[model samples]
Target: MALAGALLTGALAGCGDGPVRMGAAAVVGDDRISTAKLDQAVLDCQRQFKNDQVANQVRAALESQRQQQPMSGEPADCSPRSALDTMVNFEVAEAAAKTAGVSVTEGQVDQMIGLMGRQAPAESIVVALGMPKEYTRDVARMNAAQSLILQKLGADGNQQSPASLQARQQALSLFRQAAGKLDIRINPRFGSFDENRMTVSPVTTRLSATESGVR
Candidate 1:
């Protein structure tokens, strides 16, 4: 979710050209992220969200202390389409990595998750983002790839620096160019996919936003 550039969550955009292929939530190059897979991830987030809700209700009954579950209230946002967006985003990040000549190993991904675990249980880290606990490795790979992409491009990670800002724009441009060449498409049920912005617009706003013109 922290990829470089402006990822628009504001306006709705029209769906891309051509069909998204049956049962596939998205198609990133030859990789098919299936609807069943998206459903599983969404269901996982909902389960966690529901657990948080129930925990809150139980704690409300307590006369004294608050619940101390570290992973309880993640993903402050859980729209049904959100998971699909993330799944697609992860794939896009991987594609971008290949073009950037950056490669991530299993150990690197494990280390990434290990670092995240210091904050919260690795399994509990991404429920709020709608990623299934089983896909934690995928999320880590995305994070690793994004970090390496910026580093390779000489983009400073510090947000306040002008050089970093310019590097971020450059990174974004690289992602957009990579996306333009892939066979990427999103299922209408999940709204429209904007490759340049790497966002999925919901069905309600698909017709109002301008097309990203990505193939």
Candidate 2:
């Protein structure tokens, strides 16, 4: 399914044909999310479950339904919204990494991928992220970059890097600090991703299997 969406993206670009086509901009404060970007997020999910035709069928359907629904009335953002938030978060992390003199080189990302082994970083990243290895290497790079940023921010004394509760807190603190004064407004479709008040709905009740229109 991910492969199909990827192949269809260029064909759908401005025509607004496929499920991956960019829809409308979900403007939040100064930030504006184009439908194309949102579509890409949806594709990411499809790519994750590419191994299971049944899962792909269900996910694609649910995505199609979501595309038609007006985001204005929905109060919760689901996983796709979470994906969007991650994008927003990545921007902040990139900026923070710059300030902290923390940079993730292609070599480093490659090293991380090597640690994960064979198929490629994109594939390894799916395992690392517990996500599907879809889209392209660029997506994998972004994921690796985000992971690097989190590791750097979350690192403690450096003796033995432990992904502990404190590390998560530190990473969040860095993220918030780096995000600084950016104003983000979530569309009603995507519920608030407040660290203190996160709300996730079961995918089954909110989405349908054939709604997204993916193969």
Candidate 3:
């Protein structure tokens, strides 16, 4: 139900538009995602992984009994840049959901997390995907909003009726408009972002990057 580990990230080289912001990992519209904030998030994720190793195993075992697919394996690098990419994607998805008139309330996030808890402790799954423990609710809200928006557009279902196709197009147009209005900017220290694909890949660089707990 959650991103199912399908994070759109890689170490692949790509180009991002807009100017780099000082001390900011990214700038989405008026808000800034600070580099320090991103680093702290990555640290939190790594710490959660280490602290919840047993919980992670418990989650796997529960999911197996339920016959649910396991969460996607962690990305090879779990790169700090990739961790930032998750935040960016969540931001974009939230904006798009708002624009589409799809709302995911606190109660909805609670329900989603409740469902996830049945698979394993929500914190364990969240950290397994390299997200900060503090973001567990925020992540649940975004994923819930994502599914709601897609279901509304009939994009998540198998039906390909003309009406469904039209709805899909409408969803795409809405997301594109939302993204364009945001005018996202990324720091070269992280990587380039492809708006069309909603994917972030590292750019060519000579600068050194320090990844706490990843070394």
Best by lDDT: 3
Q: Ranking by lDDT, best first? A: 3, 1, 2
TM-score against truth, every candidate: 0.73, 0.49, 0.71
Task: Evaluate residue 118 in candidate 3 and report its C-alpha lDDT on the 0 to 100 scale.
Answer: 89
Per TM-score, the best of the predicted structures is 1
Q: Across residues 1-215, which tens digit of lDDT does each residue of candidate 2 receive? A: 76455433332111112222134333333556675676666666555555544444444544566678855223222256555654555455566566656777778767666655454344533422323345334444555665665566664545355655566666666656555444444443444335322222212222224534543
Q: What does the lDDT come to for candidate 1? A: 0.69
> How big is the positional error of residue 201 in model 2, measured in Å on the Cα after superposition?
9.4
* Positional deviation of residue 82's Cα in model 2 after best superposition, in angstroms: 3.5
lDDT of each: 0.69, 0.47, 0.70
lDDT of 3 at 189: 62
Show the lowest summed lDDT stretch of 10 residues, model 3: 1-10
Query: For candidate 3, lDDT tens digit of each residue in 1-215?
Result: 22322233323333335465678888877788999999988887777776787556754554565555334332422358768878887888889998878899899999989977885778677776668668889879877887778788777466577766777677767766776777777776677677665656666543223322223
